[model samples]
Target chain A: MTKSRIYLSIALLPLLSVPWFFGPSSSAVVLGFPIWALYSLAITLLFSLLLCWILQRYWSLLAEDESDVE
Target chain B: MSSEALIDGGGLVVMSLYFLSLIGIGLAGRFASREESLSDFYLSGRSMGLTVLFLTLYATQYSGNTLIGFAGRAYREGFLFLMSVTFMMAVIGVYLLYAPKLRRLAERFEFITIGDYVQHRYSNSGLTIVVTILAIVALGNYVLTNLKAIGLIVEAATGGVVSFATGIIALCAIMVLYETLGGLRSVAWTDALQGILLLLGCFAIFAAIEFHYGGLRSLGDQLSAARPDLWLPPSSAQKWGWLSTLLLLGIGIAMYPHAIQRIYAARSTDTLRRSLQIMVFMPLVTTLFMVIIGIVGLSQFPDLDRAGSENITLLILTDLANNIPGIEILILLFICAALAAIMSTVDSALLAISSLFTQDIYRRLRPDSSQQQLTRFGKILSWAIMAAMAYLAIQADATIWRLIVIKLELLCQIAPAIILGVNVRRLNAAAVLSGLLAGTALTLFLMLAGDPIPSKPLGIHAGIWALLLNLAIVFLVDRLRRPAE
Candidate 1:
């Protein structure tokens, strides 16, 4: 579920709104992986999963009950 | 021992190995379910979760065009090309309209095809069948454009060793084989691998470009010093119309039949919803990565023709390798990533078109056909369609934008029937059919009449023009025609 992985995907999201941000500072080394916008993407992805689960499950009159497995 | 021979040998090895891996992924279906269970085979048992769904959606959206075409446009156009980023992002944001509800219905109904949705809403076999086939054909052409781009870019990047027509046939044959085997599940799985490589390739090239030049800031400063106009928005000459873009992609991009089908195949509402959330911000990252490559190329290679803008990224990379110290490996990685983008899209599209034929056309006409029979038909349809596209892509001397415009024009016709169909219960099938036909006809007419929509069309894309008429007809006819349910 995205809820569980929000932290991970957020860690990977990239930023595209800015014109062009790649300077020497763009490749900030952290341990090994560069601390770039990709991290933010991963986190956002995770958050979306959690949010959708909450909204789809609890908020709306959308889903029919899963077919009985019997 | 020579540098040229050494680099050439390395590139060949990487290219050969990647090609073999793609076929193996295609063969992945043999270990999957037997052809007996069409549902399992085609829809991947409707069991994909957030990860596969997200990756598949990403892979399918980016396609070969993202690297070769969009990148090329950004290089030449500059700030106006930034709109390309916004348009793609807007597609994900628009998902909020219906994806949430659609996901729940798909799971509950156990629907594998978008036609099931259309058929249920309209209660009309004729309408559903027609829409389904339209979707298949539109998407077939969509994938074919990307396939054509792939062949062009590969041969261009490799320098004439691989002819464009031969490259298209070879790649398409690989796509058809894997897609015939694994279906949605295989596409999604491979998509995840491809998406990662795609992003890495982008970053690698970004790093390489920045490393060779000073960085983006210096590069931008250099570009600005040379041509300040590139940083500004489109002039009257460029025609980067905003409202038109909203309409163009709103109906055109959202109606990707494969995308809609993937929503149907979601494991749960949660999975579908999550996939869309990340989809919203995709432009900021993926599009940003590409547009920068384009802009950077402007500083690196000024005086490029309009078409040369597209080859800017590859051109820069190849030039960087040849002129700069030692970065041949980066070029190899770039080629791999680019090839992966093309193949990932090709396989997904092959599955989408073949599904349309098998389910919407074949099964609808002959409802009693068994799973084995239907899937056998699906495989045959897959190969046949691929062969046909290979022919069209190679022989057809149409511009890439021409193919994309025809594609969106056709896809725009289906938007009202699907997107609006979910909200309004009283929308009669006959009225919807009327609207769909009118929309398709108007779009085709307008498209045949004039300018490229994304590139320029009275300062608008043809899709926006067609969509306006599409929505207007849907509304007008829904009010005018009183068809009995």
Candidate 2:
């Protein structure tokens, strides 16, 4: 996939936080003790998505200038 | 805090010998390897693989707290302390946010400082300085917390030969020497050695305790009968608090300069990715080890007083180990691990903070400074910072979590500036500054008001409140700066 696609794919992980905010299980020891897995994954995916978009939109810079090559 | 120390002749010798060896290892790092340029200085040319990376990460992450302060928390709060284990597991997942992309970019640019990345991405010197300052302060607090642990070990194990001030000076000097000489390379290599000792020490002490107490099941039965809440997860105080904490600490702790600096230091994207994958499973081993130990304490010491709970972990281990035939030696080993944790974590912070000052702040003002000259001065700055921390350690605070939590509250405000700089072009410097100021003000207000223990409103962490306000202000101001799309 393109750079934007990759970044978005990552950022989307963080967006999962919205669902996490909804609620956790009453089964806390296995599920609720700390929210690192659920919340962090969401934030990471969200960040990656944003970064993917930026990289793709700025893709022109990735093109190598053959004439300038040594 | 009376030591209630069980140290005797053999224990004293083992502890003293370990200090000697650590100092010797610190000096050995000064023998420069046959490599050239900054990468060699900072990262040993990215030669570390999964094993070295894993050990380094493990030793770095656990630090003095696991052995010294964490058990104290566990003894005091009972089941509520397990939040530490869960949060650590969460810290692993938190890495997924930037680890992948950060690894790629770091390899691309040979980036060392998180400040450097922010500076390059945003082309803003102001942003770089802000990040560098925040990082230096946060790392400084981390060192202070670990230093207190160092003081405790020295006093207890050395029969008062090493006063708190003496221990701080000696350990800080050794750590700075090794870190400045070999950079991240030496630190990683030493961490590999130290991490193994740490794990062994944990398991050995744990087994000794369990065997003495008639095993895990019997211990659990005792705790459950006496303190049922110790076995169950946190109820009123902890459950309400975990929500904001999951987000606040997960993000804030991951932003440590050393953690991000490693993304740049990794040999390849695969190395970084694999190391992080391993990180995902570490809490199972690292966190559970400490939690189980803490729970076992409940059975051994029936009527443990609150004021003494902070010292309970050490007290119980010493008391139980003294009676054991084979385990007294391992208590000495734990002392080594304790020092290793303090040195490895603080040394990394010193080096990172120094680099930020030399590369980001100092050079920005004096662009023409020679690389050799700057590197020389960086070494000096590292020592200076360590010396300051040594002073803090002597007048140590007993409340480990308070120092760490307060520092994190202020440091969390950096997220909008550092994390958002990469993709959000509309996130103007003015907007970033506004967000930071607002967030910092809110955090300080809460802290200053002395909002009772644990949390304030809706069971949320104070940092989360500040961060929420910070982000909202960033976006609101950013929108005004560049109108609606």
Best by lDDT: 1
TM-score of chain B of each: 0.92, 0.92
Ten-residue segment with the worst summed lDDT in candidate 2 chain A? A59-68
Off by over 4 Å in 1: A1-70, B1-7, B235-240, B450-458, B482-485
> What is residue B410's positional error in candidate 2, in angstroms?
2.6
Binned by DockQ into CAPRI classes (incorrect, acceptable, medium, high), candidate 1 is incorrect
lDDT digits (tens) for residues B51-93 of candidate 2: 8887888888878887767776666665455556556655654
Note the Cα lDDT for every prediction shown: 0.69, 0.68
- lDDT by residue (A1-70, candidate 1, tens digit) is 3322432332222123222333333544332223332343333344345334444443243222223212
Could you tell me the lDDT of residue B22 within candidate 2? 61
Report the Cα RMSD per candidate: 7.2, 6.1
